[model samples]
Target: MKKIVAFSLLVYCISCSPGPEKNKDKKAERKKEIQRIAVKKDSLQRDTIEFVSYNDDFDYSQLNGKKGKEEISYINDQNNDRSFLRGDLIAIEYKNDSIYIAGDGETPQNAEWIVSAKKIKDGKVSKFRKEYNLPIKYHYSKEGEISSTYLDHLYKLAEYYIANSKKDLIKISLKNKEQLGYSVEKQKKNEKDYYVLGIYVEFEHRVSPFQWLYIDPETDTIYEYDLPNDKLIEFP
Candidate 1:
């Protein structure tokens, strides 16, 4: 009887010994998963502020000869990072991370400034050397804190949002007028919702900076904007 009892106790000890081994393996696996996640997240964050380009073709006759340079400007000035003046009608250009906001009139807005909220990325921005006596100048305007090349970014952001936006209703606000925000809504014949793009005009009517949002519809491509009474307006 003594021998049989000893043998049973030995069997139980052997079974319990494997539990620690299983726990050790689990801890090791957890560490690997965490490391993998850390790497992926780091790489993903780097992708947001990549360098981009903006191209414009026009007869800069009026503003030429003043700077004795490439009749057109390529220098982007956050304060005036662009190559054009405040009232230039931008036919077409390409730049990275640009956004578009709502305007009070149908014609392209004469924005001498851009409203920005995002911080500049260190590596993504072009390095403007001090040696180049470029046509850029640093000055203060009535609107205060405006960037010339700022709209370059605004346009890029607008294009990006338009590309990725899955929503139907977009609301926009124009600073010059206290009327209300504008709407970019696309309504389909058979769909209940529409796609919309909203924009802001000024921070508080003094500047021309704007930021807005869009909402994803439920199996719909377009919808009417349910604008807040304070920020609603009609656009032709």
Candidate 2:
């Protein structure tokens, strides 16, 4: 009787202990929990801020033709010969005597143009000198009033997309020229009108259509135009 009871107790203990399958399941559950937490954190960060590349081909000369307004020009502190014209859509933030300018991306690091009050009219200077907190978001103008800076951002975005999508193909070098840049046009899709920025790239000395990026003027959301499928797909 003693031997029989001991054997039964040992069987029960062995059955109650967690097996390898249970351990594997527990590990999987823990990994999934960690991934969920990481995704949540990333989503929160994206909601607060977005980054974009600065458009270098923006024409400041367009701003010069505005009637009843003095042309706004800035001297490059590093090189006095290099003059910069402030665009209508460029956002400027002032800190004490220094001014920080946003160049599409999240942080302002490379904008170093100095504009004197004497160079700009008193009223025009005030419009550009508004103090803003860091991590400024670019507010795109209406479809007809799109600024050169915004166009520059769109061009860079298209280039980035092409570089990643066509990794297998030999990379094509693009030159920043007036004829090779983006052009905006209105198109109707899903029974709604959207302003589309058409990206053109110069290859072998010839300008060719590269990609079309559709953007909602009101929301600033971008979509890739699918010509074959006649659809607009949201871009990364």
Candidate 3:
């Protein structure tokens, strides 16, 4: 009887104990789990932000029904250069029984000049606001009156950047075929709202590095984002 009980206990212990093949399989599964976690971490590090394109949401024909005012010389042309005469009044808008005509001024400074049409009503001049440099945040509506050119506005804003300034240098080399697209985003800092226009350049020919240009439509502030180097300009 003692021998029989001892043999039965030994058989039960042998069956409960883990074998070498079971231990190997467990180790392999643990290694596979660790590798999956590492791969997921690498993927998260690689994809920080995804890029997206913006739609052009402007309509030019909204100004068709409104009558155009006579084109006049630009105000605040301190240098006496009449370059403002080349561009017409951007648009005439009617809201709340008042007419607002917007135009660009000749003096290209840190801020472009804007002359608010003095005549709030039809066919009359008030001369209230002259050579005002208000930041333009006008939105074009199909029913409302507005006129804007996306390309021309961007070019006009680009002229404000200093070509020789060290801060203005964006050392991004573009391929001959690579083209850039832009989007406008609204952001806030220090309780102030700002309109930021982002320029994205495609670089498929190279190792597919990304670069971006950010411009503030309200303040005409400029910055370049270097993604590969992980550099971003800190602005006040």
RMSD in Å for all candidates:
19.8, 19.7, 26.5
TM-scores of all predicted structures: 0.21, 0.33, 0.27
Off by over 4 Å in 1: 16-19, 42-236
> lDDT for every model?
0.33, 0.44, 0.35
Candidate 2 clash pair list: none
Candidate achieving higher TM-score, 1 or 2: 2
Model 2 whole-model lDDT (C-alpha atoms)? 0.44
lDDT, ranked from best to worst: 2, 3, 1
Model 3, position 166, has a per-residue lDDT of 40
Candidate 3 lDDT tens digits, 139-225: 223442223564455544432221112442122322122343344555554465544444444445322223344555554556655
Tens-digit lDDT track of model 1 for 50-121: 223333333111121112222333223343234432222333221322222345222221222222212233
Cα TM-score of candidate 1: 0.21
Better of 1 and 2 by lDDT: 2
Highest TM-score model number: 2
Question: What number of backbone clashes does candidate 2 have, counting pairs of residues 3 or more apart or in separate chains?
Answer: 0
